[model samples]
Target: MNDGTTTLPWLVIREDDNGNRYRVGRFATRAEAQRTADSLGDHEHQQLYCVERLGARKPGPEQNGTAR
Candidate 1:
């Protein structure tokens, strides 16, 4: 099913020890993502990963239509 539509770009994602994932940044190339991740450095229970955004959002707890 190729509609010839453009998709989202690549992104640098970070994951913490608690199994939580977040989008750090977005880049036009994988190399850029890799460099950013490398420059970030590694920490205990923390890691950076490269993944495509694909027009999707990062997973997290849903809002209950109320503010904290």
Candidate 2:
């Protein structure tokens, strides 16, 4: 949290010939939300964010919705 004296950490994006990357906003409570939002990756980031992983399913139909 900011105490009216310290600067807040912001989310920023880095772009390269490969693609864009997004960094999530920081822990400061008083920070401006817009500043972080602006740093998020744009459309060019889509391909960069792709990953290979297994899909998990959650229980349903009266069962707890925990992942299986």
Candidate 3:
């Protein structure tokens, strides 16, 4: 969003099922990010995944877990 130049930090969460896929949220704020994670509880079907995916095509490396 906003030309991939966010003023606040962002977070991405996704859930995979078989060959199918489900994305939780791409939050502009840290609180929203945590909220998305909390919604996806410890369920087998609900495969929770977090990534510090910077909103940029030339993004640095994606951190393959929840943000610190």
Give the alpha-carbon lDDT of every model: 0.56, 0.32, 0.54
| Model 3 regions more than 4 Å off | 1-9, 15-23, 44-46, 55-68
User: Compared to the true structure, candidate 3 yields what TM-score?
Assistant: 0.42
Error in Å for residue 51 of model 3: 4.0
Best by TM-score: 1
* lDDT-better candidate, 1 vs 2: 1
True-vs-predicted CA distance for residue 19, candidate 2, Å: 8.9
- All candidates in order of lDDT, best leading: 1, 3, 2
Lowest summed-lDDT stretch of 10 residues in model 3?
59-68
Runs off by more than 4 Å, candidate 1: 1-8, 42-45, 51-68
Model 2: lDDT to the true structure:
0.32
lDDT of 2 by residue, 1-68 (tens): 35767544432223345655444344343234333343343344432211111132322435321111
Question: Per-residue alpha-carbon lDDT of model 1 for 1-68, expressed as tens digits?
Answer: 15975433767676665768788787776666667766675544346454544365653435111111
Which residue segments of model 2 deviate by more than 4 Å? 1-3, 18-40, 44-68
Write one digit per residue (lDDT tens) for candidate 3, span 1-68: 56978564555555465534345567677667765665565445556456454564423335344422
As for candidate 3, its clashing pairs are: none
Local error of candidate 3 at residue 13 (angstroms) = 2.4
* Clash count (model 3, backbone only): 0
